[model samples]
Target: MTIGIALLTLLHILIPIYWLGGDLGAFYSSTFMTDPKRTVGERMMALKILNNIDMAPRTTLILAFPTGFALAWAKGWLAVPGFAVVIAAVAFLGWLALAWAVHLNHGGGAGIKRLDIAIRYGVLIALALTGIAGVAGDVAIPFFIALKLCIMACCIGLGLIVRRQLVPLFGAIRTMTSTGPTAETDAIIAAVNGRARISVLTLWALVLIASFLGIATPV
Candidate 1:
């Protein structure tokens, strides 16, 4: 039972990191083109990639939370109210973020933006809380816990940097799809493409780190 629970917990933790990291890479690659020569279809493809990438994190979160809770329960760690609350909160927020993103894709831009901000902040808080709990419990695998926290921080930071670059990309896409592109639009597209590539590479590095930490440390 212990071993089974440990495996499940590890799955819950690692799957999200893998899915999010991979999707981020796909999105980044698809968008890393500033060439004004690219067709609208190509740009749309890039957007689709971005959307898919955005979907992974939420899906992983969904899987991670309940499995984590179950593992914690099996290990008798969920006995603490604070831990329970944190798990529940993280799960709820993850679900909410997923729902909001879906809604945004359907045209709820403001709602999506707000939810994105909320989820980022909430995840950060949850990581901090989880790290504290891990330390308090003196889990034999403190390194994994610390690594998870660090990955969360890195993810949040990258998201913030990418967010700033998104506006211009959006505008460029709009101009490309609607009116013919201007020099300004060309610049925006280039910037967006460059940033997207960087974000993809960054996500890849994060995934590598996550994989190392997850696999190196025995649960």
Candidate 2:
């Protein structure tokens, strides 16, 4: 029990650091990626860096659920079965495998990307439902944990928005890189990047809010 709590606590503490650090890297890379003054190769390199950094936060986000849940159960805040931690660990490991497989394959490998996306949406819905259930007295949950779950759900939702925003940004980038940069391609890149940054900022706000709530627990 002592070891479990210590490990879970450490895992929880590391998550925000992992998330924000990776996101900041990607955010910085985006500037270079969108800069038309840079050579196409340089911009492509930036894009590659951004994509690599992105995997960090994405992995952290998936692990956050199991880590948080296991921590809660370990601390006696949740009344789940004793095997719950094992189940959570298994789930986390499975998701982690799928996530890395998708990454290593460069988003290929027989629907792994699709499965990963489905997992995100499924987790988003599950977290939201759990929060609602706890609040509505269908399940017993501590106030802070329930609120944290909801905050997490919001983070996932914002992440989805960020993902969608990146699509057009990457498309414009591919156009510029593959066919040589044109005025039209540069304009599209700039526009898409600008709009995508808004979503990124929003996601950052959610991360900060979640961090604050976890730390302060004022509510």
User: Each prediction's TM-score against the native?
Assistant: 0.70, 0.92
* Model 1 C-alpha lDDT per residue in residues 1-219, reported as the tens digit of each score: 668776876776676566657666665656444555777677677666666666565455345445555555556544655477566757666666666565457545776667667766776677766666665665443556556555755666676667677777776778777987678887877777677668756866775676576556534
Lowest summed lDDT over 10 consecutive residues: which window, candidate 2?
Answer: 210-219
What lDDT is reached at residue 62 by model 1? 43
Any idea what lDDT model 1 has? 0.63
Q: Clash pairs of candidate 1?
A: none
Residue-by-residue lDDT tens digits, candidate 2, 1-219: 588688888998799889989999998998997787999999899989999999989888888888888887877788899797788789878999998999889878768888988988998999999988876778788777787888889888988877686677666766786799998888888887788788778777877777787677543
Query: Model 1: how far is 108 from its true place, Å?
Result: 1.4
